[model samples]
Target: MSQFDRQSFSLTGKVALITGGASGLGQNYAVALSLYGADVFVVSRTQKGWAETRQRVEENGQRIGFLEQDITAPDCAAAIVQHVIDHFGHLDILVNNAGMQLRNDVLDYQDADWRRVIDLNLNALYYLSHEAAMVMAAQGHGKIINIGSMQSYRAGKNIFPYTASKHAVWGLTKAYADALAPDNIQVNGIAPGYISTDMTRSLQEDPVRGPEIKAHIPSGDWGVPEQLMGPVVFLASQAADYVTGVMLPVDGGYLLR
Candidate 1:
């Protein structure tokens, strides 16, 4: 095959499972993967949002399914992995993208809130990825993409838990990659910086803070969800088969400035 044909980023025969895929970045990852030819399974707690995501995926003429899962539950990881295998026959890509952010000063933060944030953002990912890695190990080749954040590197006021979770995510990515690379299962992360999602719309609309944030981004604009498509597709494709444990930042150079 020619280089172009051999290295095409098409996911024609792949089955992808994206956690928290009912909306936002997870939804974007689902759509982008389906558009690139992968059958997608989305896991989320909201049936309403999952239905919407399913509709969009179906409109693209790709197979799409969903598992209503409360990722915070202890058994949620095993159940989700089982659901994907039962429905899709095999799993080739796993995207751990579900997370939550709570903004409270370290001194004022509630213990419950901190536990909730860490449970969802860090613990759940660990459990889910552990289950998925077993499936990937059996298959001998698979991709595990963790969704990290700019907070992985810098501190943000009133968001201690989020920062801590992201930092842990980075470490998890490296550790998983080291353990799994020998088996040909690649683990990596994508750290998105200030993307313009509904979650961040309030920040964008804030007259006092919006412009200040934009000014720091060398791109002079917030990144759109679609801008993340390429990076995600690349990470999930054969092109990145030899790449693992690296955190690719899709932050529009916000990290630099």
Candidate 2:
């Protein structure tokens, strides 16, 4: 490959931080970045499943660390960022992948439920990004990858808070990208579509809505968590240095139909 090509893709010696790294999409992202040579720092609410993720990352010969904490807490963002700096000394990438969703009709949505979803999905993400951005600005370069969802652009039933949070996330991504560009910090988002993860198991298995959802996807099937690996890895690497504020959908063309 050419010099530019190599520079764009390689993440050797870089340090990355991923929220929600214990399981699901977060775990996959941690491993994928490790495969590209980034040392990974993972934050999750529980230590469960972290051992497997750590093993997968170390198998690629990259350093990995994990911290168990509730990201929804007000002080969690600062703590997580400090922990990364303490352990790795520097950070090159931060993936805001920790999120929560509540399925309830708008009329039935309780204030507490709405707060719970927004607290993590949007609030925590913003706090974490803010802290990471400060460090990245000081370092003169960094990547911030937020985990948006298809709900970011379109509407879905019984997911009011989640939709609101995701839509806000895209806005935050753009706002941060614009604000941080001068500091060489890039902020972007990934909107995954109909991925086969535990979070979507209930919807995907719904006899009434499942087939309708599959038919809407041009690929005629649901995507697996692994399908997100490439898009995320690219966004987190030097390949996306010039790409910011955009929400790239890894959605099997779901938006087309």
* Alpha-carbon deviation at 165 in model 2, angstroms: 0.3
Q: Per-residue lDDT of 1-257 in model 2, one digit per residue for the tens?
A: 23476667778989999999879899999989999889999999889888899899999999998898998887878888999999999989999998887788778889999899999999999999999999999999999999999999998688999999999999999999999999989899999999997878988999998999999999989999998999888988777778989999999999997
lDDT of 1 by residue, 1-257 (tens): 13556447999989999988879888999999988899999888777587778888888789988887789987878889899999989999999999999987678899999999999999999998999999999988999999999998998779989999999999999999999998899899999988897889999999989999999999889999999888899999988888999999998899897
Please give the distance, in angstroms, between residue 47's alpha carbon in candidate 2 and its true position after superposition: 0.7
Each model's lDDT: 0.90, 0.91
lDDT of 1 at 83: 92
What does the lDDT read for residue 180 in candidate 2? 99
Compute the lDDT of residue 48 as modeled in candidate 1.
Answer: 57
State how far residue 49 of model 2 sits from its true place (Å). 0.7
